[model samples]
Target: MELLEERIRRDGVVKAGGVLKVDAFLNHQMDIELFSQMAEEWKRLFAGKPINKILTIEASGIGIAAVVAHHFGVPVVFAKKTQSINLDGTMYSTRIQSFTHNRIYDVIVSTRFLGPDDHVLIIDDFLANGCALRGLLEICESAGATVEGIGIAIEKGFQPGGDELREAGYDLQSLAIVEAMDPATGAIEFRS
Candidate 1:
């Protein structure tokens, strides 16, 4: 996690309205080695849990989830933002508001890939307001699956998301928790 914090300090960009863009390594043009290290950290943190599946929302979270699933030796199931023709059978759907995009998306997951037997580890690129993760949790609830834990790459500690999840009794692990950010100075402070 120190590696991730250091990377964020070096490469992360701070924008107005509390946005931290980490596209250079964390999300857009991914650093697989960094992701692998993050995955290893999560694995160590959540050790001994029966995590049979990895779940994440589509788009940014997919790449990180894939590498994490590989490390866990489990299948990764991403909740699609839009329902496609390829997705068949009963689907668990929920609405999620995107903090970055500033839009609400109807996210869904196919029933075939998730069920009561699965113990899932939810992974994502970022957590701000807890909307996306809430939607994914709803789908998991509808499917009657056990949520083993939640793994996040970056979390804006100024926001209520991460704290809310932890208060709700979730075993959430965030690699980098930004305690504060200065847009003008491009300074980021991480929680110790």
Candidate 2:
């Protein structure tokens, strides 16, 4: 986690409107080495849990989730933002608003992949308002699956999402929690 915090401090960009762009390394153009390291951290942190599956929203989260699934020796299931022709059957669906894209997406997952027998570990790139994760949680609920834990690469501590999830009794582990950010100064403060 310290490695991730250091990377954010060195490479993360701060923009106005409370946006922190980590696409250079975390999302857009990924650092597999960094991701592998992060997966190891999460694997250690969530040890002893019955985590049989890794769930994530499509796009940015898929890469992280895949790497994590490899470390956990579990299959990764990503919720698609749009239903495709290849997908057919009973599906668990929900609506999620993207904080970065500023749009609503109808997210879905095939029922065949997840069920009541699965013990899931939800993984995502970031957590701000918690909309995407909330949607994934809804799908898990609909499937009657047990949520073992939630692993996040970065979390905005100033935001209410992480706190709300924690208050709800979720084992949410965020590698880097940004306590505050200054757009003008390009300064980022991480929670200790």
Candidate 3:
């Protein structure tokens, strides 16, 4: 987690509208070595929990979830933002608002990939508004899967999402929590 915080300080950029662009090393372009390290941290954090599968929203979260899944020796199931022709059968779906794109999407997961027997670990890159993770939680609930934990790469602590989830009794772990950011000065303050 210290490694992630340092990396964020060194490479993360503060943008207007409370956006922290980490595309240079996360989200868009990825750092697999760093991700592997993060996976180890998450594995340690969720040790002894019954985590049979890793769930995440499509796109940004897929990379982190995949790497983390490898550490847990579980398959990663990502909720697709859009339904595709290849998808079939009943699906668990929910509407999610994107923190970055600022749009709402009907996120879905195939019923075959998740079910009542699964103990799921939800992973994602950022927890801004918590909408994406909330939607994923809905899908898991619809499938009757027990949520083991939630792992986040970077949490904007200045936002309400992380606190809300914690108050809701989720076992949430975030590697880096940005307590505040200054778009004018490009300074980021991390929670101690």
Candidate 4:
């Protein structure tokens, strides 16, 4: 987690509208080694949980989820941002508002991937507004799956999302928590 925090401090960019762009290594160009290290940390965090599957939302979540799934020895299921031809009639869908993009997307997951027997661990690249996390939770609920836990790479603690989820009694873990950011000064404060 320290490694991730350091990476964010070095490469992450703070912009207006509370956006922290980690495009250099995380949200854009991929860093497999760092991802592997993160996966190991998540594995340690959820060591005893019955994680049968890894669930995530598409676009940014897929790569991180895939690497993490390797540690769990399970398949990765990513919720689709749009309705795709591959997805059949039976699917769990929810609407999510993106804090970064400032748009709502109808996210969907195939019924075949999730079910009552599954113990799911949701993974994502960032936790901003918690909309994506809520949508994934809804999908798990629809499938009657037990949520083992939620793992996030980075969380914007200044946002209400992470606090709201924690207050809701969910077991959530974030690698790097940004307590505050100053765009003008290019300063980022991490939670101690």
> With candidate 1 superimposed using the best TM-score fit, by how many Å does residue 59's alpha carbon deviate from the native?
0.3
Candidate 2's TM-score:
0.96
- The segments of candidate 3 whose C-alpha lies over 4 angstroms from its true place after superposition are 83-89
Give per-residue lDDT, candidate 4, residue 169: 89
lDDT per residue for candidate 1 within 26-79, as digits (tens), equals: 778999999999999999999999999999988999999999999999999999
Instruction: List model 4 lDDT by residue over 1-192, tens digit each.
Output: 899999998999999878888999997898989999999999999899989999998898999999999978999999999734444578888888876667878898888889999999999999987888999999999999999999999999988889899999888999999999999977999997
The digit string of per-residue lDDT tens for model 3 on 1-192 reads 789988988999899989899999998899999999999999999999999999998798999999998889999999899734343558888887765676778888889999999999999999987888899999999999999999999999988999999999999999999999999999999998
User: Which pairs of residues clash in candidate 1, taking residues 3 or more apart in a chain or in different chains?
Assistant: none
Residue 65 in model 4: shift from native, Å? 0.4
Clashes of 3: 0
In order, candidate lDDTs are 0.93, 0.93, 0.91, 0.90
- Clash pairs, candidate 3, are none
Span of 10 residues, lowest total lDDT, candidate 2: 82-91
For model 2, residues 1-192, the per-residue Cα lDDT tens digits are 899999998999999999999999988999999999999999999999999999998899999999999899999999999734343568888888877777878898999999999999999999998999999999999999999999999999999999999999999999999999999999999999
Better of 2 and 3 by lDDT: 2
Q: What are the per-model numbers of colliding residue pairs? A: 0, 0, 0, 0
Give stretches of model 2 more than 4 Å off. Answer: 83-89
